[model samples]
Structure formats: structure tokens, C-alpha cells
Target: MDGADYLHPGSEWAKEPDDIDSIDFSPTVTIMYFADDDTWQAVWGGREQLGEFEGTREEAIAWARERCNTIRIYSPSEGDIVDLVPDE
Candidate 1:
């Protein structure tokens, strides 16, 4: 199917989707803002998330920095992105 055996079901090549929520993705730290609740989130190692009133952009940046000296801050809404800590 689709000219690809991998795309054919029961071809021993098709597999069921894995549980992504149980899997960790990127291994970097990044901060994201939620304007609706005025909350900032710091995603740590893509494994955990911290969301709290320490939620301002500055606060979020600080929080991220404390845990990881090198982190990335990006704003999709403002089209702004900057790697606050330069790579060494």
C-alpha cells in the first residue's frame, strides 16, 4: 500500500502508535508563556513542567536559569527568540 511495504498493515512493518505522553522528547530547557492566565511555564529537560505565579517572563527566565545555566527563551507570538546564554 502506498507503494511502501512499511505503509501496509499486517505487513510486519506497520506498528501501533506508541504512548508519547509517557515518553520524553527534547532534552533542553525552554520557557513558554500563557497570556490567558498570565502564567509562565518552564519545561525542564522536556520531562517535567513548572507553572506558577512565579509566572512573569522575567521570573520564568530566572527560574529556568537557576535550574539550567544555558536555556532558550522564545516567543512565538512576538516572533522573538533569543538564546540568553551563549554556548561555550
Candidate 2:
């Protein structure tokens, strides 16, 4: 299946299983900030937290489109949707 196949209804986007598996489990939305510098902050979610990840922004958008939903990427200016990645 493609990235679109994994999107959940009403959600902004979904990631392929490969990508989702890479993200560190968190209780909340992972937050990343960009200013003079870039910083990333992760929020852990409860066991009930449900979501997925994409390998790229385009994939994420496609997932969103498949679900008829819109995603807002977290940014300092207006926020931007981005594919979640695992921390090194």
C-alpha cells in the first residue's frame, strides 16, 4: 500500500508503515521550532495517542488528501507540516 492508504479519517496526514515505525513514540504532537536556529521538541502521548508518520512532506500531503483532511506543520512563523523522523 501507498502512503495514502494509511491515512486516518479527519487526520491531516499519515505516514507509510516504514516511516511511522521510525518515529519515537510520544504522547503528543512532536514540536519543532525554527528561528535564527532550529530546535525540536517531542511530546510523549498516552497509550491512546494515535497517529502515523511520512517519509516526506509530499507523502504526508498525499495522505492528508486521501483522508480529505488538512495538516498544519508546527513552525515559529505560521507552522509547517513535516514528516516525522526518528531522533538519532
Candidate 3:
């Protein structure tokens, strides 16, 4: 606590949040492009390949936005983990 930078597990600085829903939770949806198929897939939870959906990039984005509040589209050029739906 002296340094006032590090947060220990049980330290007072790490108090439990009162509003859990307000937290910026990670996206449970991921849209990936398959070059072999020339289509995009909207994967649920992770890259485990669950809940398949094949479409164009715009169509995939629309599909993801309709079903969930957040989505992660795979960006090869940019950095990983760019949320389609950022926390307000």
C-alpha cells in the first residue's frame, strides 16, 4: 500500500463492485473470416466454432449486432480484442 500503485487480492483498493452489470464485460461473440470458404462466421463465446453463421462482412456485423450487445471481429492488421460494442 505504500507504493499506492499495486493492488493486492485482499487489499481495500480492490473492493467488490456494487453494480456488476455496469462492468465492461468481455464480448461473448467473435466474427472470423474463413479464406477457404470466402465467408465470415459469427462464433459464440470463443474460437471453439460454436453457433455457426456464414455471410459477408457487413452481413456478419449486422447479424452479430442483432443477437448480442457486444461482438469481436477478427482484425489481422489491427491489434486483437477490438470490441464492436464498447462500454458506455
| TM per prediction | 0.47, 0.28, 0.53
Sorted by TM-score (best first), the order is 3, 1, 2
Work out candidate 3's RMSD over C-alphas.
11.8
Per-residue lDDT over 1-88 for candidate 3, one digit per residue giving the tens place of the 0 to 100 score? 2211223444442467787776655546667666666777776644343465779988888777776776876554542335675531
Per-residue lDDT of model 1, residues 1-88, tens digit only: 2212213344322344477575545555666555567766666675555332247778877777667665756554433444666531
Give the clashing pairs for model 1.
none
Q: Tell how far residue 62 is off in model 3, in angstroms.
A: 0.7
Candidate 3, run of 10 with poorest lDDT: 1-10
Among all windows of ten consecutive residues in candidate 1, which has the lowest summed lDDT?
1-10
Q: Is candidate 1 or candidate 3 better by lDDT?
A: 3
Q: Over all chains combined, what TM-score does candidate 2 have?
A: 0.28
Clashing residue pairs, backbone N/CA/C < 3 A, model 2: 15-53, 26-44, 26-45, 27-44, 27-45, 28-44, 28-45, 73-80, 73-81, 75-79
Alpha-carbon runs more than 4 Å astray in model 2: 1-50, 76-88
Residue 29's lDDT in candidate 2: 45
